[model samples]
Target: MEEERNTYLDELSGDGCRIGGYPIFVQYGPRENEELRTFDTLLLQLDCEYECDLMFGDGGIANFFINEEDLKKLDFTKVLYNWDCC
Candidate 1:
């Protein structure tokens, strides 16, 4: 059951650092907030880099999101920031 659940969640997310793609959430996702759900474009994602000896509070990943409209308009003042860890 645990493995099955993990697979299910994995299908819903992509774990990594990326730009202009869907976020790889380590914990809470955008669905938790109505406003966040509107931020459809992923601006940036920074995952823990083991080789670089960098971490965001124990394997946490950081994500930045921007509304599609805002991105098109080149507005970055409203980017939403979120991070989580195991």
Candidate 2:
């Protein structure tokens, strides 16, 4: 028998990828600059050798940045990184 499970993917959406324990959602905009890019793509955009920083925000929801540096620093893998892309 298969038990039912409802994850963040199940809660928010079913279009993103999961890394460690965090649910990630991606949306590529129609405009050239607004489009979402891959690691290498963003690297080229910033022209940096180190890891880049990404943040997301909205109206009255507060702002937040997603950084693997913090994750690696704290050695945590279950914390949530909720970014509303709507």
Candidate 3:
């Protein structure tokens, strides 16, 4: 039981890929960039998944960010795409 609880916690702490959630960067955060800071919405995050044979150059994570206003307007022309690895 204790082991199971720990496993759950570990999963929650892990930075897995998701859509429309916070980004889990492998390196510097989005806050480091002024332009990225304005793009508050996380559109997509693709993390390295060995089980699914998906990778982005040595366990890199890909992220797409967009401004809340732009997202609400359904304008993806100015979305920012970034990726990083360990």
Candidate 4:
């Protein structure tokens, strides 16, 4: 039974994907220049160890899975780079 369950989960995670929970989407205003500002807002609301897939273009969208352990080790400041100024 455990083996079957594991196999099912593996199948579900195919190509680095899983089908559970809803994604959190965030959009920044045109006037906002800092990327971290939006990131910080989203990061604070999420728990650690949460799985997140982010997409940014005209706007920013983040899909996070709650995981408390992962949240503790995340360094948002270092991760969100400022390429325009750099």
TM-scores of the models, in the order given:
0.76, 0.19, 0.82, 0.19
lDDT of each: 0.82, 0.29, 0.85, 0.34
Q: Please list all clashing residue pairs in model 2, or write none if there are none.
A: none
* Candidate 2 Cα errors over 4 Å, as ranges: 1-17, 20-26, 29-65, 75-86
User: Which scores higher on lDDT, 2 or 3?
Assistant: 3
lDDT of 4 by residue, 1-86 (tens): 99998988766432232233432334432214553234332222221222453324433332333233334665433333221100
Alpha-carbon error at 65 in model 2, in Å? 6.5
- Tens-place lDDT digits, model 3, residues 23-67: 888888765877568888899989888999999989899999998
Q: Rank the candidates by TM-score, best first.
A: 3, 1, 2, 4
Model 2 lDDT-worst window of ten: 39-48
- Tell me how candidate 2 scores on lDDT: 0.29
- lDDT per residue for candidate 1 within 1-86, as digits (tens), equals 99988987766457656787777777779657986788788899998888888799988999898889999999998988888888
Candidate 3 clash pair list:
none
The better candidate by TM-score, 3 or 4, is 3
Per-candidate clash tally: 0, 0, 0, 6
Q: Is candidate 1 or candidate 3 better by lDDT?
A: 3
* Winning candidate number (TM-score): 3
User: Total backbone clashes of model 4?
Assistant: 6
* Candidate maximizing lDDT: 3
